[model samples]
Target: MSTVLIVQFIALAVSVLSFGVALWLYTWVKSQPSKNSRVETIAELIRRGANTFLRREYVVLAKFAGVAAILILLFIPHPIWTGGALDNILMAVAYLVGTAFSALAGKVGIQVATIANKKTAVAAQQGIKPAFLAGFRGGAVMGMAVVGSSLLGVTLLFMLTQDATTLLGFSFGASSLALFAKAGGGIFTKTADISADLTGKVELGIPEDDPRNPAVIADNVGDNVGDVAGMGADLFDSNVASMAAALVMAMSLDNGTPGKNVLTVFLYAALGLLASILGVGTAKMGRGGSPTRALNSSTYVTTAVYAAITALATWQLNLEWRIWGAAVIGLLVGTIIGLATDYFTDDTKPPVRHVAKASQSGPAFTILSGVSYGFLSVLPAMVGIAVASFASYLITAPLGAGYAMFGIAMSAVGMLSIVGMIISNDAYGPIVDNGRGLVEMCDLGDTALEITDSLDSAGNTVKAVTKGFAIAAAGLTVIALLGAFIAEVNEAIVTRGLNIELLTGFDIMQPDVFFGLLVGAAIPAVFSAMLILGVDRNAQRMVTEIHRQFKEIPGLKEGKAGVTPEYDKCIDIATTGSLKELLPAGALAIISTLVVGFVGGVHAIGGFLTGNIVSGLLLALFMSNSGGLWDNSKKYVESGHNGGRGSDAHKSAVVGDTVGDPFKDTAGPSINTQITVVSLISSLMASLFLTFSLF
Candidate 1:
């Protein structure tokens, strides 16, 4: 068999292995004991609420995906009447499959996470080791599923179709789903989180996760939907988009055949997944090991293993060292970005400590300090992305024409190479956050509280780092997509027999390119505002509901034995409000890309993607880091650093964290998906844009 065929089989084998591991992890987590009747009942309520939100979200997403698939069938890659009917049919099916796979992975995360939260809390009574193992292993299920399905789906689709254009259809489908899932989930989460914090912690000075607070259950449910499911979908979309972009370019450079370059891409991606699986397997906490240290160490192991294995593979396969170097640069930069983000967001770091100190004065200083540190935190990640792109280009440009761009694509693939590990780390955050809440409200014990609290703090810090890592990867991924757009446009130019000059690159001096550039820059800001505003609007309603519950229900606030806050009511408010607000913001991102493509054609799109990526990366990093900083600062105060819980400093820190709720969780992470969606949409619609633009 040819190397490509061998690699394809190997990829499939690796994918299957990941699924096996995920199954084992699931079974293992389910076996963990949680016999507390109260914990069980509350966990059931959380699980039900989370599943309800996901079911409703999927119902709405199904309609969107349905409409999108039909459109892809009719127009994408070509019009139906122009032939390639088989390709169109497969594209639509593949698109739907992509959505289904992404949705399934997310559903799996919710299922395991809800169960694991109870297990982790109960196990914490045994000590941090068992609790940590339960939480980490539960998250690893999602990590494995996401990367495994992405690898399998891409492999099978490519093996069957042998058309890169079809992969774009699949990617666009993933992106479309991810965009809405992230937005809607973010809205749902922030609404409940902000309401619970303000009403319970700030207004009434009640403990967080207090059963007397109606929004507490909704808040816990949001952790699953928004953080676990939504973030899983987001990373899933990024991994697929990066691969699709690289494969599209790899095919052209290989003269549309399964050449050495093509084999290299498959091999590298497969190896990356294998490394993450090992990393997850080897993750262990010491008797009193810092959860942050344990999590960071696993990521380091994954990174080292990927680098070592890829290097050996390159030598054995006789692949170009230049390309391997480019990939490694991307990998190294990704690690640096994560570490830098940890610095800005981690509680042990000066930035977070300073932010906590600022809260000593009041909430105003808290906001100002967080915003400043957030903006400052953007520099390292941005610089890292730029360096990765430029260095990868420089190292591989000598290989041949188009190789430079492929190098950047490979860089993206390499940067996200350990995404299985990244997602494990990322998902660990929310699961443990939920564990902390469950432990607190279930009255598990003060020991359980201490363990989950430390784990939750680590989760918050690591989630921010991973968000930065993801956005940086998207930065390179979208740039590669821009290059793919050019490849598609030129291919279309040849097929249509048009006498136009094929685009090499967009010139910003042209008015059309500059117009798209300016418009694209504004889109992320507008998108962020809409999402944050959605949270603002929904939180107000939920807050009013929270107020009504406390005011109307007898002795609910006083923690009377028979009094229970109506948790289901707040859940309904979040579920209903989120679904209503999800579509508009995502529609704007996709629609703007279409408008730019039609109004100014391919050149405009090239510039538009550029502008959108730059703006989106900066905004995403700032919001994620700053929000994380504020969150950790609050934890710091609550830990009795600046001041103990219920102090003026604690209240001010709570305000800071509250303002940051939508910033990091809602808009920041979603923008990464938003930009990827725009890039994929542009590539899918490139032929139409080439043929029909008035300009």
Candidate 2:
């Protein structure tokens, strides 16, 4: 066998090992003690609500996926009458495989997270060590499942078809699922979150996660659905797109000698997963140790391990040092972006304190300060992405034609190489967030509540950083996919014997290109608006329901025994409302891309993607950071920094946080998937656009 095949097998083996470790972790979490009946009852309610939402969401998604599959069969890559029927079928199947794997990964996350919340809550009664372990390991299961499945799916598809275009099909499938999963999950989470806060804290003056609140259980369920499952699907989409984009560029390079580049991408990704597994295995906190420190330490360790292993591989395999340099640049920039995000969102930082101080005046000041800092926060991440792309291109330009673009693709792979660990950390946030709520509901004592609160606080801090990292990786991935689009369009032109010259690049001076650019820039804004509006409408409905229950259900607000508020009703409303609102936003994104491609040809589409990425990144960064700032500010005020809980400053901070809930959780992160979907749509339809576009 060739060296490439050997390396490919090794990557596959590593993927299998990741699954094994995830299983072990899952079982270990399950084995943890959970003897309290009240804890078990609350946990079961959360589990049931989460599963019901997922089942309903998947049912809706199935219909959407089926329609997409048929459309792919009919028109993608080529029409059926062009004698490409077999290829179309294979592509459709690949797409289905992608969606199935992504959905499965999310299911696994939800399952383990629900179990871990109870375990962590129970363990906290003992101490921080066992509680921290339960939350971290539970999250690791999700991380391993997501990265492992993405790797295994990519490798298996390539091995079967040996076609980069088919891999694009699989990626589109993942993007499709992510579009709905992220949007729907985001809306569900924020809707529940906002309603819970509005009714419980603002109106009733009750503490968070209070059993008197109808929406509290729904809020906990939302943590799993939105953060754990939704985030897992989002990263899965990004990871698959990165590999698909890289393979497409690599296959078009070195006079068709794509083996070396393919092997290099696979090897780098596999090593990253291995590094994450080791990092997860070693993650631990001593008695009274900081959860934030433990989480950050594990991330640093993973980065170091990935760098060491990939450097050794580059040296031994005689790969281009320039490509390796590009990858390193990406990895370094990703870390820098994370640190920058942490500065803006961390409560210990000045940004959070500043926001908290501003809250003393009013909610308006809180919003103003947070928004200003949020805009400032966008600069570093945007610059980092630009630097990584430009530096990678320059470094590899001397090698040969097309290598520069391939280098950019490699940078994306390198940046996302440790996505396994990123997902683990991201998932860790929601698991512990749920644990904190469970502690309150179970009445596990003030000490246990405090311990879980600390863990949850760390989870929130780390979540902000990981969101920045994930968004940056997606930005870089889509930049690489733009190159793949050019390659795909050119190949279609050549195969069809078209008279048009190959597109070297989009010229900014062209009218069609500029038009597409303006339109594309508006898309992320419009998409975000639609989602936020959905949350607004949904939250209003749920809030009304909460009020009705409080007024109608006697003894509920008086803390009378045997009179629980209607939790399931709020969960149902969130589920149904999210499903309803998510479809239109996702449809708008896909439809607009198709409209642009068909309107001005591929040139217009190129400009469209460029605008989408720029505006999307800006909005995503602004909203995510500002939202995190508001949240941490509220936490800071509650910590007695500004007037303590129930003070005027705390009330103002709550208002700011409520407004930010949908901004950060619902619309911001979903933009990452939206851009990826448009990019894949452009690539998948390149052939049709080449032949059929009017302009």
Candidate 3:
């Protein structure tokens, strides 16, 4: 075993152990009897009532899960598990089957739990069974179905892309970029939803730290454990697995010998898994009361990994200065992007009376700081891409280094906070609105719910979604330009022995072709927006139906009928907030499509758009759903803490006082893997497509 492999194994084992310990402590705490930490005064009671709730199961389950994961790690055998075209095909098939089964199983379990919770809660309230209790089961089942279908779709996509590139003469470069672009769009959409849920809905109705707030408990568990830990596992399992598989394939092609650098793949896999855990853990630990702590840890972990990997790759691969150069360039690019965002971002603070104070150079300094930070963020990603692409060139057989570079470049862009923020916003949207609706229902003594400050989260989600679209636009544009250049070179090389007339009509910018590419670019956003609208509408309808049914209950007859204006407004804000954003997003997409198509050709643009959409959607769905799960779990805990009974006055008073669950859901889930996946998947697809297209 290589030294690197040994180190990786050790790290993975430690991660598992640490996760186990954390879970054990959490469960231990929960198993104990509830302690009444005194409410010192009336204010204290009000505060304590809201802030004390936390799901005790997270720690317990996490520990067991962690330990289990470690044990599972041992099963990953030595030697390259996947090599050659046949091996990749089989690996893709396995991933597809595994993800499908997992999704189905998870969905069923969730539904059963939801059903049980609703049924038991209602049965205690009334002598008769509650209809909504059954609704929980249906919803859970439906959720799982959605997840399964989505995963199946993605897995199939990966299969097709790989097959097309290797077996069929499809360009790896084209397919990969298209997937990433699509995934980017989806990630942005889902992230925006999450943000809306946290800031607008959750913050307005219930604070993250409020133990009495069911929303609080839900956010804690749903966003923290589900999003952070679950995502950690999922991302590591899927993306890292795919990457490792791809790396093995690429290296085999380059080396012309299957055995060369076999240990590197294993080592990287271990590192990737560990990194995944830390990436998620940092975010989870930051929520409720420790935002900065979680964020800082995440930053540190990512930085350390990036630095270590770059150093090792450079030394082992004998890539000379390219490694450091790539890292530096990445950092610089990231910083520039950050600076631009900071500068362009309009000051959201209310108009101040002191114009001089407002005009202070603080904005400029902030821009500079953001730029510098952006550079830091960009370096790791850039270096990763650089190493992967450049290393391909040194091998006797080329594995399409150019396409690898393209993917890496896109991945680097994903590291930026702008991408992270956009993702966070989408994931939080639904949760926030749900909280607001719940609070409003309680306050008005009506079936109708009212909510204020509920649109903030929605707006944030929209903002993030828009920003992500813009980023995708930019990424697609770059890929297209690069692809066009590659095509030109390929045409020259391939045409040497053939009659030039056979390839003479190869116009890169066919109008009909370009049009299709443009359409594809816009498709992901449209699909995501429609999905969000559909899901939210369904949720609203269900909640409304539940409210109506509650009115039929004898004791619940105190509430009035119909939806309130506030609730209506909240819905409008959440649904339509991104509409205007769509216009700009569309424009950017169009511009990117045109630029790339014009420069490279219709095929390149199409590939770029396709890859982006696929990757974006996958990332978005992962973050949004996972975060929602976390939010729900946290709510369950808070519900139990609030004397296992609903309390409105207490939930409302402290709801406005708490900062949202930004750390666990947004900074953690939305920011890290969701964003990273967009780039990673795209790059892998691009490289694979390049090889296929060449043949």
Candidate 4:
């Protein structure tokens, strides 16, 4: 076998090993004790609700995938009539595989997280250390499963098809599922969260996670579906996109000979997974260790491990040093972005505390302060992205004029090399968030409450960090995808024997490019608005439902012994609304891409991707940070600052949190997937756009 094939097998081995680790972690989390009947009952409810939402979502998405498959078979790469039926068949099958893998990764996360949340709540009665371990280990399952599956899928697909373009079809499939998983799950989570807080906290002054609140269970369910499943899908897409883009470029650079570059991509990706496995294995906390510190420490360990091992491999395997530098640059910048997010979102940090202080003046001041700090927070991340992308490009430009973009793609790969750990940390957030709720509702002693609160708080900060990290990675991945798009367009041009000059890059001096840029920038805003509005409309309905339950269900509001609010009703509303609203926003993003591509051709798409990247990054950063700021500010108040819970300031902060719920959880995070989806769409449709466009 060629060296490339050997490296491919090695990458495959690493992926399988990661899956083994995931299985072990899942077993470990499952074995953790869960003794509280109340916690078990409620946990089962959350579990059931989450599964219901995911099942319905998949059923709908299956229809979508089917239609997409037909389209792929008929038109993608070449018209079926053009006598490329074999390639078209491969593309369709790969696309289906991509969607299936992404969905399975998400399902794995939900299954483990549901079990972990219950165990974490029960374990909290013992102490924070055990609970932290339970949550982290559970989340590690998702982390391992996602990165493992992406690597495995990419490796097997390439080995089987030996075609780089086929990977784009697979990526588009992953994006299709992710767009819904993120947006749909976000809408569901925020709908329940906002309603719970509004009816329970603001109006009736019930404690957070109070069982009497009808929306409370739905809120917990949202944590699993949105944060666990949605986030897992989002990261899965990013991982796959980064690899697909890199491979597309790598194959071109390698030119079918013994190829070091492709080997480097697979090996680095495999090693990154290896590093995450090590990091997760060592993840632990002392009895009184700060959960935030433990999580951050494990992340740092993973980063260090990846860097050291990749460097050694570069030397031993004769991989290009410049590419290594680019990858490491991406990794370091990702770490820096996470720290910047932590500063903005951590309650101990001034931005969050300042927002909390502003809440004393009422909700408006809270909003103003959070928004200000949020905008400021974007500076560091933007600078980090700029520095990483430019530095990687410059580092690799020495190799050849054509190598710079590939270098950037490598950087994204490097940055996400530890995504297994990132996903673990992220999934841990909602698991512990559910744990915090369970403890409160079960009346676990104040001791357990304090432990869970600390874990949940850490989860929130880490989640903000991971969100920043994920968005930054998406920004890098899309830049790489842009490169991949140009590569695809040029290949298509060659194959079609186009009379026109081949595309090197987009020139914004052209009118079509400018038009696409303007339109592209607007899409993020429009997409964000649609998802947020979905939450708003859905939340209003849920709030009304909540009020109706309290008014009609005797003793529900009073917490009467035998009277429980109908949590199923709230879950059903969130499910129905999320399914309804998700498609329109996703459709808008996608349909607009098709419109722009058909209208302006490849030049417009180049500009379109550019504008979408710039504004999408900005809005995603601002909304995510500001939402985190508001959320932590409320937590800061509840932690006995600003007159503690139920005070006027606390109430105002609750309102701020409500406003932020959708911003961070729904629209903000979803933009990453939106950008990726459009980028992949542009790549997949490159040939059609070139051949058919009016421009």
Query: Best lDDT goes to which candidate?
Result: 4
* TM-score attained by model 3: 0.43
- TM-score for each prediction? 0.99, 0.99, 0.43, 0.99
Tens-place lDDT digits, model 4, residues 44-83? 9999999999999999999999999999999988899989
Q: For model 3, what is the alpha-carbon lDDT of residue 573?
A: 30
Question: How many pairs of residues collide in model 4?
Answer: 0
* Pairs of residues clashing in candidate 1: none
Q: After superposition, how far is residue 531 of candidate 4 from its true place, in Å?
A: 0.3
Q: What is the C-alpha RMSD of each candidate to the true structure, in Å?
A: 0.8, 0.8, 15.0, 0.8
Candidate 3: stretches off by over 4 Å: 1-92, 97-238, 241-249, 252-269, 272-290, 316-508, 557-695
- Identify the runs in model 4 with alpha carbons over 4 angstroms from their true place: 256-258
Ranking of predictions according to lDDT: 4, 1, 2, 3
lDDT of 2 by residue, 1-695 (tens): 98878887888999999999999999999999999999999999999999999999999999999999999998888998879689999999999999998899789999999999999999999999999999999999999999999999999898888888899999999989988999999999999999998888778779889999999999999999999889999999999999999999887873455488888888888898999999898799999799999999999999999889999999999988898898988998999999999999999999999999999998899989989999999999999999999999999999998999988999999999999999999999999999989999889999999899889889988999999999999999999999999999999988889899999899989998998899999999999999999999999999999999999999999989999999999999999999999999999999999998888889999999999999999999999988988898998898789998888899889999998888888898999999999999999999887778889
For candidate 3, give the lDDT: 0.31
Over 136-238, each residue of candidate 3 has an lDDT whose tens digit, in order, gives 1222222222222222332334334432122111112122222222222232223333433334334344333322221222222232223222332332223
- Candidate 1 has an lDDT of 0.93
